[model samples]
Target chain A: MAIKVLHHGLATTVQDLGRPGYFHLGIPVGGAMDRYAMRAANLLVGNDEGAAGLEAVFIGPKLEFTEDALVAVTGADMPTKVDGVAQPGWTAFKVKAGQTLTFDFLKSGARICIAVSGGIDVPEALGSRSTYPIGALGGYKGRPLTAGDELPVGKSNLASEGRNVPEALRRRPGPSAELRVLPGLYWHRVTEESQQNFFADEWKVANEADRMGYRFKGGRKLDFVDREQPFGAGSDPSNIVDSCYPYGSIQVPGGTEPIILHRDAVSGGGYFMVGTVISADMDLIGQLQPHSPTRFVKVTMEDALAARRVRQLNLARLREALA
Target chain B: MSARYTFGGDEHLFVECSEEMSLEAFFTSLSMAKGVRESGIKGVTEICPANASLQMKFDPDVIHPNDILKEVKAIEGAAARAEPVLKTRIVEIPVFYNDPWTHETLMRFRERHQDPTGTDLDYAARINGYGAVDDFVGAHSGSPWFVSMVGFVAGLPFMYQMVERQRQIQVPKYLRPRTDTPKLTVGHGGCFGCIYSVRGAGGYQMFGITPMPIFDPTQTTSYLRDFMVFFRPGDIVKFKPIDRDAYDQAVEDVDKGRFAPPIREVSFDLREFQKDIDGCNAMLEGMLNGH
Candidate 1:
């Protein structure tokens, strides 16, 4: 054991890039919500891009180091400290043995990723160190870390510290975020007016947001087109015959709440998804806080592809810079 | 063959085979999903087949999304005339009807149910034209079920009855979803039945509880040794109702890692089953008991 948890922050857990191949088994690709931040933290600490790290939400965990090691904190704008002294985020720093690390209240963003010299030394479950609490698999015993839990750290490669990512390299969305969505298969299920309203409306993130999904409130109720209820699809106009819910898809139950499926969502369900948030914007969704004003900007397939390409290039730049 | 293909953002391709849920549509979707997997497509990462639709997630960087779409359309055209046959397995799941665990949970969520005064079973029986709950249970257990999709949660099988459409057991989900549902509780909603793999929020009408655990991450159960998630998409399931004493014995055996369920391998032909469903089903059942 290398790190002892002095205080369990709000919903802190070990995460990596997650197990992608298991989506067919109904096991979601659950990992760090903000993949970019997680990768940045790992890169700063000289760890592999997808190495396991601690994903702390809202608040940060108070941890005491049992051994001197390199560490980096990324994502969010929370203030970090080492044994009462201040520390800069997104920059690798060393903590001496017996030194305590803590955080001030969150200043901005939703989640923070803390990467140490070596990755979290948890045995891989299903070829991943991601925590999927729904299935009770992976991570530190398949659940969120709590106070008094002593975590094991992998053998450090002994890389030098103080490598900070440039300010421009840090990716965070604005306070009022505009998420581009590509409407799909079930788009025709809604009336044209309601579809326009969905794009035009300004919504606020609900308190129900978590790893499974983020629900948006304060939007006009969506209206569905009239159709003979399909056989075997429940009577609700919004219900489909249980279909796959693609990651980042927006599912509206009863034409009310619009939930954007996130990292730990179910693979398939009966609710109809209006559209999917573009892959480039999923990371942005993770950094959004509850009650944040958000807009769903509709985009075409080509637009979505172009955005994905731009983000891929940015990630490439990050890798090159760190390398 | 004219499946409606829609792009799910930059990654997923959603293919809708039919507007309504049916055994034929499920097979059609499954065939396409299987065809995509076997084709060794460069970018396809995951293929999930649902009731009457399927989704394939591909890396757009490796293969352009449109190029993958063209390949999928070609595969759909190629499998258009081929008869669907699945070499699958059939397993018996022992259940205790009206088990006290589910009964207590269902009672707590009565406000969300369709008929608040009556139990879920009685309400379902009345809506489906069954004279009593016993008759409804008989009809439910009498027919074999196909695991059309194993999802919503890990290892949770969404099943469709092998019986004709007119004989299918249908129920609406609770007016509102309950905050809690007992694990392994047999649930029915729409025309599908699902076994809750883990305890969580649910809206389906609770029918019973199974003695066997279909989902185990630890793989501690003897039946789950081959895989942590027991039920697959193509397996057929038959529910065998047992009394309280038998249910207790099965639980005890499961705790001791001695529960080896009755399972058999068999090939399912859509054409043959369509021609003589009951006859083919009887033969399939006979194979299970060595008749």
Candidate 2:
């Protein structure tokens, strides 16, 4: 069974956890920015955590199911309705054929994840079903879900009755709060005052936020301490060099504002990385809408690890429950 | 340190522990570990080219992610004590500041300050003594650089300094960002890193163009290193200049090479990318049909 695209509102595309380990190929890990929500929705529908789903940014599309299927919606609060009736969040629903699923304007957060039973059947590209629009390599023709696109779904006889995501596990509000971070690659190069501003002040998301990175409008430009080339530029300053880039890396060029890289960011960059948002807190960053207030909250390494452990334990339990 | 091996799959495995650590330090540690190579992770197709996260694609049939997570944690722990691996090169570029008008327009008071008696010119005078430009640019060769990150184009490594200098250059705001800034031109007013490979729009006040190829596509590995970059953690890199002849020799081959087949015309590909326009109709068919 497949779902017919009635109208793809805003920017909707197929995204999984993401495509990682291919920075060398010039590909960023373009996946669900809020991976937690993605997993939640997937688990609710009994699909594998890595199954392909819709990453509905801003307002979601009006989707019409062509066949009876189990689906769930999570992440970000969009005004969701089925046949004009208000729908709930983070639980699987059996939608009959021809039933229309409509999502109005997003009330909070930037993106929402929709998972269907048997997962969205998109052709895998380079080992992933995630869409990378820039390279046109993955997902539905490597592009955003459009108004007329039809998406296929694989068959699965697994009962949807048991795969429901519990109410306690639903994504709660507070993702718009301060982001936790680790000191960046070149944190020392920045002025002490800049460090204070980074933590203490609320930064506004600049107009330049995209899948690649988020540029913030804030006080203080992180500058290099020395004029000499720091390192990593192979003998010349041309285009190609052997290099690797990390996630949540904040690159500051000559601009006063800083750009924080996200899921679809490039594999390499030539600017100074003043800091990286902590992995545990990166999901919060994914939910930040434009002009959303963001602050960097510094955490010890131990705290970050503990937070990760908590999340891992949660995921492990879900898997064990499925088993 | 063994003969290389390649793993296959579509799963991304990251150290859940990367939250509070230095991204530079994190990758540096990974590069130093052993048995973290391809064989250890059976389903991992490739290691992503990123500093902050270690991405690996794996096939679910071959290896389950939960089983691999245990090994990934071990690799993360092993990375802490490993010596840093360096993926940085200190290449010095020559700049003549050939335009006298540009110099006069930019720094009008420099000639008067050249006198030995002038206190204002003391810094320049000290640097001018005994092949100073050569000596200054050459100073970078001895120091090692850390491969901080990569992107802009493939293999464009951004390195960082572990130490501070006595005098740091201030980057003045660009008076104008040229919409059509030529590629390969280094910006004026600052010694920003070179755009080694020439492909896209540049913002730097381009001083001059070097006649060498910044990136090479012919090599077996498109990216320079497999595990880590050229520079280790906490290393320094200083630039050293190459003469015109050396630069020419390095770039000549790529300049004359023919485009590989399955190579669609650059114009067509660009049009496909800009599909919203009406004139792009010629390319939209390829986009819709999953070409």
Candidate 3:
């Protein structure tokens, strides 16, 4: 099976769960930012969790399926249409031969994952099929999916095994305001006021935000003696001292604004990691669209763990339901 | 620059577990911790290098944040009392220092530095060179150089922060920060900050080339993800610079399996085409894996 890319949306590219442990090699983990949604979509279409699929940002593309295909779109609740007919989100649908799928303006979230039944058959790079746009490597020719790009589908009958996106899993996303975080690698470095304000304040996603990092505006500016600090934005005049791989919530310099690292964040960073959005809450942050106001909530490690436990149980339930 | 530096307490969490200790002592104490031994944290994770400081990654479900704090407090003394296994191996890296800065580049660096004294300019040029002395010279006459952190990107290792004197003469960043710049340059050939998975434009200064491949996907054991790097927040590094011939010999030895990268470690040194070499290992991984 194959699908012709009629119009590549804002920033569409094929991604999977992303490559980990390679951060030390100067490779960013460029994968589905909203992994939870990506997995759900893959399951909806009877594909494995790590299947290569389209991570369409802003809006999805118009595609023409050459043969019958089963597809599912997850993440955003945008206005998606099939052959000029409104289609529902979070469900599997069969596109007959020569069917055209198009997406309208985004109603929420920055991106969505479109998983076809027989996962995209792109050549693997380092055991993954994610795209790294900056270096022009990986994914559909090492770049975002472009108009007229033809993607071949792996020969598999996985779609015959029907899977469903449970109603609970299909629950509409919550308010884009409050964000949850665990104390960062250097959370204590910020002033108490800054820390308090960080959680209390609402910051708008700056225009500069991208897969590399989400640069936000208006938390609290750091007030420290302008000595050559080693962490954060503009902290070091030279290159950042190799430190640790980013685990999300790496605070770039200028503590005035905080950056929530995303899937494509570099492995090691010099900036002080102000806080990491807990694993359970990371998908929430990932789904946030630009200009969405977000606030940080300091969850104790216990709470973070509890949240993860809930998510784990939820995943188990999802798998059982699919089975 | 040596004005008594008193770190602000409110801003930073400074848990002084020891007044003075060697890398061996620190490692020993950490390796023998109760949490690591009893909590089953060791087997659960890949590499947990116990050094002067044991940076434990907590799974929120298994370990609470407060529990980690309690663990840190309870283990600080244990880490202090413990001793490290001191079986050290010296990995010789090959390097070729390339002068990429033209007159314009030099001028830009000069303009970036607020105080462009001759010494400052010299220091900018020395970024490539100074890293070598700082890592190998024992940080000032037999002073033990501690391994501050083991960074990713072929596991580029960072020894310690620059000395107070070396901090005085530093270069300024160019007008635009290049995110795709490779982590290692002339001096700190084995330094971290190399991107192993993602390739992007960066602005780190480039100087030398190292023949010892820091990373190569063709090697069977190479997995940007599986190879766990060994270095802790406070392990000691004995930096020793090797010339071009030694670098070539090291590469030859590595290729022949005389020095194959361990199942946990990956390393590379860019001694030629400073720009491309920095990202070669990561670029190769991406290309090899179809990332």
Interface RMSD of each: 0.8, 10.0, 8.8
Error of 1 at A65 (Å): 1.4
What tens digits encode model 1's per-residue C-alpha lDDT throughout B30-111?
A: 8898889999899999999998999999999899988999999998976666778889988888889889998999899898
Query: How does each model score on lDDT?
Result: 0.91, 0.55, 0.55
Stretches of candidate 2 exceeding 4 Å from the true structure: A161-163, A223-243, A317-323, B1-291
For B1-291, candidate 2 gives per-residue lDDT tens digits of: 111111111123433223222334335434632335744667755554333334454444466556665666666546654544433223333333222322332243333332323221123324334245344333322232333444444334444322222321213213333334333333322222333243443333333344433344323222322321222222222333445554455345335553211111112222232244334422322332235
The 10 consecutive residues of candidate 2 chain A with the worst lDDT sum are A233-242
lDDT ranking from best candidate downward: 1, 2, 3
Best by lDDT: 1
- Residue-by-residue lDDT tens digits, candidate 2, A199-244: 7777888777777788888656544444334322212212111233
Per-residue accuracy of model 3 over A1-323 as CA lDDT, tens digit each: 79999998788898998865344334556789888788888887888989998888777888999988888888887887779988778877888889999998888777788988889988877678999775455688878988899998986565653356777866455556676676655555556766677777778888877777787886666544233444212344222333343356546565566777777765454545565776777667667767888877777656766787888888777767665
lDDT for residue A322 in candidate 1, whole number 0-100: 82
Rank candidates by DockQ, best first.
1, 3, 2
* C-alpha TM-scores of all predictions: 0.98, 0.59, 0.69
> How far out, in Å, is residue B287 in model 1?
1.5
Candidate 1 lDDT over residue span A184-248, tens digit each: 86999999999999999999999999999999999999999999988988899999999999999
